[model samples]
Target: MRQSLRSPQQHCPARRQPLPVRNRVHRAWPVAGVAALAVITAGAFTTLAGLLVGPLHREFGWSRSTIGLASSVNMVLYGLTAPFAAALMDRFGMRRVVGTALALVAFGALWTTVMTAPWQFVLAWGVLVGAGCGSMALAFAATVTQRWFVRRRGLVTGVLTAAGVFGQFAFLPLLSRVVERFAWRTAALTLVVAVTVVLPLVLLLLRDHPADVGVRAYGAGEFTARPASAPGAARRTVRALLRSARTGPFWLLAATFAICGASTNGVMWTHFTPAAHDHGMPATVASSLLAMIGVFNVVGAVASGRLTDRFDPRRLLAAYFALRGLTLLALPLLMTATAGPPMVTFVVLFGLLDVATVPPTLALCRELYGGDSAIVFGWVGAAHQLGAGIAAFAGGAARDAFGSYDPLWVGVGALCGAGALLALTVVRPSRT
Candidate 1:
């Protein structure tokens, strides 16, 4: 009996198995799809702020500056919240953090519909939505790609970044019409419904790590255990910032990204519709043009991602920034009361350039910082928002003071030129 038992034990199978077949679709893709959807939803809220400017000003007799102040607050908090959100993902898990963010966004949208005062608007739109969207910002994309993918990281990052901008600009035409035909409250309510629908999907489908699903990250050669959740999310975030701050690349990335924010999110996203309206285009037409930009942004960002995988990301950054600057400089000449050929040309080119910088920037962060890339990129993103907040307010103030957005465009264009030069100066970290 003992001899028979020994024989059976010796014949038992080994515990480990070969890595799963590559032919099968990885779970990462589906997770990425959900992440993209979440980002798109968050982006819709970000761009929705621009649309509210006109309606609020008209309805409440608030000045453009006052509306812009709320936008500035939103943009600032949106950026400031990213690093913490990233760290929170590490501590709490992506599913929980993201779901909470969606909830906050939904609540903020609902609150906006009922607010009567400027402070109330700022509290609802600025603080809550900003924090919510910030948590879902590009850093969220970076975290997902890094954690769930070991291949095609750049491509995935580009797609997610594009999703955000696509969400922002794509819905503008419909939302603008809603505001024009019905009321701004109707538009806010619409956002609440959209966000609420996405929340449950996220809670159900989104997983914290690849290991959670009995798989490794897509393209990983072998399975590895998920890292232990670090204690103190806030402490980790601060420590990451402190360590990264010592590096020259961090500052350069932050500065360039700030300009990126100022030019794109600040001046363009926030003020373009109002500026176009000022020049003679109807709100719906202006929004349609913006929507076209959103469509092409997907193309540009994805193409840039593919390129980043193959080329030197630094060079790509230089080219993208320089071209963006030139395009912004030409905007005043191209923008007219009507959607002329010149304006359309500007829209096509600008849309293509809009968020293309993100993939390369994220790649640079990964290349330079390795494991700390997500947190570092979060800080860089905060700078982007800082620039955006300043530009959003400045653009509004400039409009109120000077009666035109032309000067603001010219100023931001010049800054983009500086950003191009700054991109070239980022030094690659030495691999020991």
Candidate 2:
């Protein structure tokens, strides 16, 4: 079991020694960097997939739906990996779990460089990369906030979650250029190098618990013991999942998040460039637009965090879903052969709502799951990805079947409308 750090203030009055001023500085800030690195490393692959779709289709003669199946596997495994990873983090350590995940990401990328068949792509990108990325998903952010800090958790969660956007926007434009200039193998190699670069930082800088440094979480006035893990962590995961399955709140939260994942990762991230290409925009232009969206996502995600800290999370979530649905509804009408004012407006507005769902969703998890928030939230993440996986496959199939993406967009927008209503139904447990 991990040991807990005690604040100086919590020590016996007579035995207390002064805590060095620097020691009390929140260590979570640096830990957040490590967490962000993991997310960024995972996100690099996710952001680049859209650019790869058209190229893969042209070179391999694979249909868009065939390529999307790989993405579907990736999304499904990504979601399924989270809760198990959280349990492992509790049993092993952050450094071990994170390091292993990164290695898997690197290896998955390396394997993708040599793929000659669709099944190989599915195994590498879908199973391996998806599992690796899922291991470091928002659950890592949740783990960091819960274990490393007592105050400012919302703010940190927001920043860490925004790291996904940063990874996308910062890298997507450049990567689109890379794909334009080089073979897909070069792009796969780039992911290998990028994921490998963060491994050392994670190994050297990250600690599983603040107690490793002999200081309490920032603003904590007393020591709290880390809870012991169950003898069988896999069994524990099943139990927590079964218990959460029985709760009305869990189903409501999961349903909303499924819509969230379908909207963001499933349709938009996977198909946005191709969808734009359908209207005669270049892939590079679409990626740059996505990069722009990433910039605004930072602002929106951070503001959402602050709002969640002070406001009713359910209302914030409802507003976010409603606004997102409206923007998506407007998207079909705004499509033009080239970048224009309407497209620009959609990018800006949707960017602000992009990952804005994260902070409020996480806040609600804390309220709902209490002590098991991290692991329970992991299951919710799975539901989100399950939706993404289904949507990713279905969106591509729709494009193939109908020769247009319009139907997919309309269906997803309507689902978002349903999600907004569902968000309001989330019952907050009364505070004692």
Candidate 3:
């Protein structure tokens, strides 16, 4: 009450009260919370693209490689856009960046309904949609970490990371059914409508930092006064940031994230829907499988976050890559009967492992790289997308040739094992 500072919102009462425990989670309205909302939006759109893959293939008879390319471009552009998003968020308030991104995403998804060819797909789903989601995405994660939290960062991150998974889990089935009954165009348009619903939610509730509303953070449950950053720190020029990006941890984080992209979105998002269909699974059933994996992605990612808090992040990284590699190797065989117990088991196991690597990767970025963490994560995630982009094309090619995803499973698993070794050798930080 003794001091006043400029903030994004002036409407809040000077004496803000604590949120009741149940509502406290909402009160945090924290970056993690915003990230969760963005995750749902991103996941829905991402999985919507996958759900459409099967129907689009059936409608146009485009080769897998061709369809994969569209998703490839999306992932590539998505990853490529990450660092800029982080930088932009750093420069502006999270509210402007995320809300604008959501609006763009909804526009892109809606526009996809009218596409007549590959180029149209590329313009809508690949470029605009991907970039939009990528921008706001872990924005929540990065923003929350840097501002509202100093402890339990990994746990908060896990919840946010898990949001995308839940979105995929919850949205894919509904989308698949829409595709089954209406058409691929309907699915895309439906997403446009769905994303429209989240826009107001984002605009009204989201804020860049707790200070913006004349309040201290929620969970810390104490109102000690401190500026979120040093004066002028938030407005630092890009040159200062680029200079920092060249540090060692920058490359390490980007490399690990590239591996992350290759292992997850590269194969799963682009191929899984069609692969499930190819194996004789109905679209609805396949969607259920995808959702089941999302359920486990939440569980696994949360567990990884907890472990990240307790263990050496690098060791945890190694284990995640190795175990994920093993899972990839086993999947082609296990996911065979789309309607059986094996399929269920595969979904459960794979989903659990799906985004589990994320918390560790992001946690390590913050722990090792410090102030440059989000931008570092951005570059690393770009690598992840780059890998996914390559694998997206390759997975399609292997399937077209061998008439099975078996070869890709083995190859991707090997890549994951190599990634595990890389995680092992990730150098530790010395005292800065």
Q: Pick the candidate with the highest lDDT.
A: 1
Alpha-carbon error at 4 in model 1, in Å? 20
**Candidate 2 residue lDDT tens string, 272-388:** 989998999888898899998988888998999999999999999889999999899888898878889999999999999989999999899899888778888999999999999
Compared with the true structure, what per-residue lDDT tens digits does model 1 show for residues 29-136? 989999999999999999888898888998899999999998999999999999999999999999999999999988988999989999999999999999999999
lDDT for model 1, please: 0.92
Residue pairs with clashing backbones, model 2: none
Model 3, runs deviating above 4 Å: 1-26, 218-247
Candidate 3's TM-score reads 0.88
Which one wins by lDDT: 1 or 2?
1
What is the Cα-based TM-score of model 1? 0.94
lDDT of 2 at 228: 66
> Model 2 off-target regions past 4 Å?
1-24, 225-230
- Residue 287 alpha-carbon offset, candidate 2, angstroms: 0.3
RMSD (CA, angstroms), candidate 1: 3.9
Model 1 off-target regions past 4 Å? Answer: 1-23
Compared with the true structure, the alpha-carbon lDDT of candidate 3 equals 0.76
Residue 121 in model 1: lDDT: 92
